[model samples]
Target: MRVEIDGISKSYVDSAGAPLHVVGGLTASIEQGEFVCIIGPSGCGKSTLLGMLGGLLPPDAGTIRFSGDRTATGEMTSIVWQDYALIPWRSIIDNVAFGLEVRGVGKQERKAIAQGYLETMGIGAFANAQPKQLSGGMRQRAGIARALASDPEVLLMDEPFAAVDAQTRTLLQEELLTVWENHRKTVIFITHGIEEALLLADRVLVLSGRPTKVVEDLKVPFARPRTADIAQTPEFGELKQHLWERLRDATRAAEWAEVEGANS
Candidate 1:
């Protein structure tokens, strides 16, 4: 396994200063270069889990471990946030090279590396263009370019395409598949969209509501080089229905538990 998550738990202070548990004893593992997607009901700490996985936040208990050629130095993980987080003032190429520059690489070297990624992302022509000049999909391509330029061992994405239109989201999903095919980086993607999860992941982990855990772990049976048309197949429909039922039951259980606690 490239990543092993063992009994990971996290809590936060609520608005009333009460301790709110978000995740509890969540355990799973991602194989080296495997792509996994996580889906859960709203407010189920999906982003919080991604944060912990990316080492952006520390868990209150448990651990996330990386093995198999992962290094102590340099960035082993990079994130693509939903908002695209581009530097509006910088050109697209500069934005992609931002990480390398921060590591003290020479401007020429960073630009060359960033340009290469931009080309791979099919955004090389926009290298000199400002972020504001690009469309939502184009800007997101730049964000992906930025993350890949770091040459991460694992890529963590928190709903990176949520802000785009449906058509554009589909296009970006295809783009992501193309990129992943080339680099084969271990990816842990978080999304609310079930179909998107099914389409992209080698496996899908469904999470429970607050105080979340893995409610179900489903291996995607579809072969690689998948297309949107797969969603229409009977097998895809079957899996989707099963996942929906599991998620519905998990959500209902959480709501019922909350209600019972309130009454008690």
Candidate 2:
């Protein structure tokens, strides 16, 4: 679960033939079983960085290497996307088992494994239901269960709770902590929610505006089993305010990143 991200950067060529930089010289490391969150302003390349770490996208100028025995190539990763991305035709249980099916696991075996995560994610009741039948929060939980059922060593989540309502979002955040506590997988979650990162992560990586890089990598001193209760406490407010101040500067800079030459 140990990951070394060394000087990673990424750029996309725009329609007008300019290079649009996303990540820029971002370097960091994640110890085994650590829950790491990357917090940033919107469009700050947090998900781009996560994509590189997951081996889905190549960095333009750096390396992502896993130096741990727990996972070869970093323990095989599962990504919980912002969009639920469930198969409309598949039942909930079948959808959760989809990743395992890709790896050639037998149906019965995969179903057994999927069943465990479905219960863990609190969506086992929806096992026979279709994605269309579920609420937004329930669908997200199913998406998470689908990822966890594979039992990967690393879980990369890209704003998994953002699409739901605020109350449902809060509930989902708590559910995510429970799952993370039990699994202890090395997790790198991408979110723009300052408080969400503070509540859910062991450490937070704050990224700068586009051509994004690490602005701050601060460890959270909060105790385990973090809940909404902690959110109203003095400690929580202090951390929240601190992160907000840091992000306020980044937000101003985020506007400049939209210019064509950052693409150029």
For all candidates in order, the CA lDDT equals 0.91, 0.87
Error of 1 at 144 (Å): 0.6
The candidate maximizing TM-score is: 1
1-264 in candidate 2: lDDT tens per residue? 788888989999979887778999989999989999988888888888878877788888877778633223433888899999999999999999998888899999999999888899887877999999999999999999998888887899999998999999999999888988887989999988888999889999988998898888999999998897888889889999999988888877787656654575
Stretch of 10 with least lDDT, candidate 2: 66-75
C-alpha-based local distance difference test score of model 2 = 0.87
Compared with the true structure, model 2 gives a TM-score of 0.94
Cα displacement (angstroms), candidate 1, residue 49, comes to 0.7
**Candidate 2 Cα misplacement greater than 4 A, ranges:** 68-75, 257-264
Model 1: lDDT equals 0.91
Identify the runs in model 1 with alpha carbons over 4 angstroms from their true place: 68-74, 261-264
